[model samples]
Target: MNLAQRINAFQKLGIFFKQFSTAKIEKHSNSEINTLFFDAFKMQIERAQEFNGWFTKENVLKAFESWSEALSVENLIEWTSKYSFSKNTSPKTIAIIMAGNIPLVGFHDFLSVLITGNKALIKQSSNDKHFLPLIAKFLEHTNPYFKNKITFTDTVLTDFDAVIATGSNNTARYFEHYFGKYPSIIRQNRNSVAILTGKETEEELALLGEDIFQYFGLGCRSVSKLFVPKNYNFDMLFKAIYKFNNIINYKKYENNYDYNKAVYIMSLFNILENGFVMLKEDKSYASPIATVFYEFYDDFDNLLNKLNTEKSDIQCVVSNENVVDFVKFGQTQHPKLWNYADNVDTISFLLKL
Candidate 1:
């Protein structure tokens, strides 16, 4: 298929995703073969949580909504406008190793490879095995050209020109060792942080609660740490996030809260807690579930320098325009199509291959 055809196919796929993007599924009148796929996909979404505890209906819908909003005609055009696709060039097969941390987490890489006219050989994480394949089926049905272009394997990946892999810091070392000879983009563990200036309105901090509680704070884009000014009041932060206190109603989340709270109490570490979330003074970027690590900064200049120096460990900086290139509060998970992971341009890298 040509570039226009590829874009159209994904645009259709996006439309398919939109049907499931809400608590109540809404079918578009013009959707392709909706009778064949729509109800089936809904069943898959309903059963997703049984397959993986983290894939709650609410979180799955949030992911679908985000992708639906992201895959508009304007977004597809803007995202792909910069690349030149040569019709005469042979398309390569790009292998993708996806992380199952969140629903459809590796889809951008999958979409990038296919949009660039390269075939995709995806090795999906066992924890997140069901949803993407159903979408792939919808794409193939939308356009027959996609049939030969997509493949999913559970075994070791093979016969691909380049690779894109996302995993933890430990798994990254394994990826680098195994895929080192080939051209690759291997992503390591990176966490997002919020920088509080003690000036954010209650509304903004409430929005920040979405960034933290969404997906139960399992996503890399989820803000797991906080960088606050000295003597920042915990009362305000706790009060702003009280709306999400219901998150503790989920058994898995409540278990984590109890466990982490118990560990902290046993260790006699000072922490601030409401019923659902806890904040502890920690320098680490990655925090445990049901907890957000925090550290106080005395000097804004030093904080900026420290964040800059440790950029590799950070995926995004959430702030109120205090830091350069920082993501606004509550906007990290809503990254635009062009917002590449690890700040590595996936499309540019795919174009080179």
Candidate 2:
């Protein structure tokens, strides 16, 4: 298919996604494919948590809503316009090793490979093995050209010109050792953090709660750490995020809270807790579930320098302050099509292959 046809198919897919949202499920169109796929998607949303405890129905719907907004015609055109798609270049097979920490987490890479006129060989994480195949069927039905362009594998990934792999630090090493010779983007663990200036309004902080609680804070974009000014009061932050207190009621989260809290007490750590989420003074960027690490910064300039120097370790810096490339509060989860993970342009990388 040509560029317009390709983009139109995804736009239609987005419309299909818009019908499934946490707020409500309503058919906005009479497209027959909706009859085939709508109830299927709803079943996936309902059964997702059974497949992976982290994939709650609410979280799955949120992913659907987010992608619906992201795949609009304007967004697809805007994101793809910057790239040069040479029709003469034969499509390469781009192998993608997906991370399943969040729903449809590997989708961007899958989308990128296909949009750049390449084939995708996907090895999905077992944590999230379900949804994508059905999506592939929907797309194939949307555009027959998509047929034979997508493949999912359970065994070794082979016969690909280049690879895009996302995993933890250890798995990344394995990827480099195996796929090092070929052109590749092998990503390791990276966490998001927020810088607090003590002047944030209650509204902003409450929205920040969304950033923390979404997907049970499993996404790499989830804010796991906080950088606050020295002697900053914690009460305001706690009060602002009280609306998300219900998150603790989830059994998995509550178990984590109890366990982590016990470990903290046994270790004689000075941690602060308000029933659900715990705040511990820690230098680490990656915090465990039910906890957010915090550090005190005496000088703003020094913090900026530290963050800039260690940019590779951070996925995003969320703040109201003007930090270059920083995301706004609560927006970490709502990244646009152009907000490339690890700031690496997947389209550019694919085009080079």
Model 2: CA > 4 A from native: none
- Provide the TM-score for each candidate, comma-separated: 0.97, 0.98
Among these predicted structures, which one has the highest lDDT?
A: 2
lDDT by residue (tens digit), candidate 2, 297-336: 9999999999999989999999999867989998999999
Candidate 1's clash total is: 0
**Which residue pairs collide, candidate 2?**
none
Candidate 2: worst-modelled 10 consecutive residues by lDDT = 83-92
Misplaced by over 4 Å in model 1 are 30-32
**TM-score of predicted structure 2:** 0.98
Prediction RMSDs, each to the true structure:
1.3, 0.9
Candidate 1 local accuracy as lDDT? Answer: 0.90
